[model samples]
Target chain A: MNWTLMWDSLPRLLAALPLTLQLVALALAFGAVLAFATALLRLSGNRVAVALTSAYTFVFRGTPLLVQIFLIYYGLSQIDLIRDSFLWPVLSQPMWCAILALALNTGAYTSEILRGAIETVPQEQVEAARACGMSRVRLFRRIVLPVAIRQMLPAYGNEVILMVKASSLASTITMMEITGVARRMIAQTFAVFEIFIVAGILYLLINFVATRLIKHAEWRTTPYLRARA
Target chain B: MLDLLDSGLTSGLHGWGPQLLSGTAMTIAVALSSFLLGLAFGAAGAAAKLSDSLVLRGLAELYTTAVRGVPELLVIYLLFFGGSGMIMAVAGIFGYGGLIELNAFSIGVAAVGLISGAYSTEVIRGAVKSVPYGQIEAARACGMGRWRILRRVLVPQTLRFALPGLGNVWQLTLKDTALISVTALAEIMRVAHTAAGSTRQSFLFYSVAALLYLALTTVSTTAFQQAERYASRGVRRA
Candidate 1:
């Protein structure tokens, strides 16, 4: 291993770190909101709502993110109608295209994770809340949301890490994220292994921190387990 | 508009569609072969991890931990760049002094196989652990040899529990094939990518590719679910 080369490249790679963080952070935040809405609709009693959310999740999760990004960036642009449309501003940039794809894709998976957590929130508790005359809104806000979000924390953390890794795919579409920078460095230095190694270590470090945070959250939530520990 | 769409489809099919078809073939072949390779490694790793020997146990643990800890894309990249050199080095030791020519298919298969093997190791290890020790002891008392005991008492039970996890690994392997585009393998993603770039119609090609993958996932999921049903038929579900 070229320790000197690795150390030297770290500074340049770190410079590109902000965009990578922005991509993952913004996508996850936006995706989380979309996911919550989608999951709620998916669980709703309304047939139309359920059907729409189901189709959305199915289509998004069914496809690879790379395909979706390309479609948004290149495919949709071919149409004169779309090019002239209000959406053109958003679709014009590769960053937006990448974010759109990542958000939509993660939104689908996140909805499923949130849905499972909500479903596992036990029916009896909801019944008890209802018996106390809590309104539906209050019931969901005070009872359902907290439990579901807490349950979702660990899985969502994994999704967050997966998104960080998946963000590398954005490089395919001309976005200069971490993997993009790494590729450029490789192209210049002709050191594919060394550049990728540094990039991989960066990813591993980010994921390691995320995992520890998730574990800490898990510990805090499950006080009973913490007490035993 | 519908007629336009129809004509567009026809034009695409007549143009670069054959490349996409061939890519799909490559994807399936790579996924299948890598999956089989993964199964072999998974079984061995599982056996080693479950074994009493510390050496075998340590080897299995390291294999699972290192591979799983690293990103899949990194693994694929590492194999793509490092695999050739390693193969050539081994060939050199074997006295074959020639250029090492590895096809894209082999590289794709090997990379995905390594990734699948890591996940499969965990799944198969869990499956092996789920097998009842009492059954193994019973087979031993019946004067069955180690191989016979494993064949009769262990393998069947392991498959039953391993099916669901293996199914997940299969879906993962299927999606991971998309990463092979880096190698210029002309898999569905690559074909769609080139078509998108040339036509400047990214949506059409990508949508088609995405649908193709979804179709693959759906069909495979159905097959695995059927296998799961079959496997659990004799045994009662919780």
Candidate 2:
């Protein structure tokens, strides 16, 4: 109802947008690589790889991201080795810690998504590719990977938005992202509703745009399924 | 000593175990209260969405979409701050001018209930739609009233279909309870946070927190699977 305060809070919240975006982008990039490897590891015949990846996913997915962030940020600092080692420079920064936790957490969830998607890729296509003397890597690259990616997009899109929301947890560690700035402003102005509503709108906008981009990608990738114009 | 610490031994947990366990209980209580409340909201919302009234459908759509689209933390903050005032204002209409306090536990349950309700709404709606229309029609033909039909023909099938989706929502509801630590509720996350700050064993306590959450999810997932089996007993599946 405080229209003026809500309007005034918008710019400050907007200023935090880049940090939020950066957390999402970096975490997703790292998480994508981690997820792909995890998915492949589960598919791999090697027992060690499968066990390790499953445990990785289990631990990360089992816990809350906020717990992970605190453990990485405040927790890791308690260790003398991490503080003394070369890792300290990066781990000491709260932003990096947040990014690390977010990436690991998202990685676990996405790996499951990717694994399920890849498994849904029809066995006949892979069989046909193998029968044609296509190498394993080539068969996966030309056939399985493409099909899986297409199927994975919708779920991955959900993961992306979830990551964006997860990024708000980063604010707890003093990242000053959208939610962080809003909390700070609220403390200053006592306009908790105004600031939070503005911040929530900012998050909704990000997710809205993300959902559209994913939907567009889905449409583009599934050309064979499309109706005539 | 370093090896023991590196392995995150229970040495650090010597005194904090009881506190964390109590906090876990609080978290469970809150999660359960919120999950029950959410189920109610979800059922009502699904009914509204399935109703013939356009306005009811629109309002239900708005509730689910808006809550799902926004971050849970923001909604918690919004409710926790604005909620008490709203309650007090309503109470004013009843001739109560005295200051009344709603505890953090209730606020947390109500707020998280609303968030989880949005998710459960989608799941319940899908489950309701999945129920065969012919079955309902057959029930009506048998001279069954609406309530009887719902109780007999609809509820069981919906439960069977909705269990898996509701399992996912339950996991969500459980995790969202962690966010309520931002309030004054002495839940698991807040306890770990406080213990970490005091004991400076952030790694140990948080690892415990993570372990505790993992245990909760694991147990509930198993329970849901059992319930799913029980619900679908004697039913055919592909």
Give DockQ for candidates 1 onward, in order: 0.57, 0.70
| Candidate 1 lDDT (Cα, 0 to 1) | 0.84
User: Mind giving the per-residue lDDT tens digits that candidate 2 earns over A41-97?
Assistant: 999979999999999998898777888898899888988888899999999999899
Q: Residue A192 in candidate 1 has what lDDT?
A: 62
Q: Measure candidate 1: CA RMSD.
A: 2.3
Model 1 chain B: worst 10 consecutive residues (lDDT sum): B1-10
Per-residue error for B37 in candidate 2, Å, reads 0.8
Q: Residue-wise lDDT of candidate 1 within B23-59, one digit each (tens)?
A: 8888888889999999988988888997899999999
List residue ranges in candidate 2 displaced over 4 A. Answer: B1-12
lDDT tens digits, residue span B121-194, model 2: 99999999999999999999999998999999899899999999999999999999999999979999999999
TM-score of chain A of 2: 0.97
Docking level of model 2: medium
Predictions in order: chain A TM-score: 0.94, 0.97
Give the top-scoring candidate (lDDT).
2
**lDDT per residue as tens, model 1, A43-82:** 9979999999999898887666767777777777777887
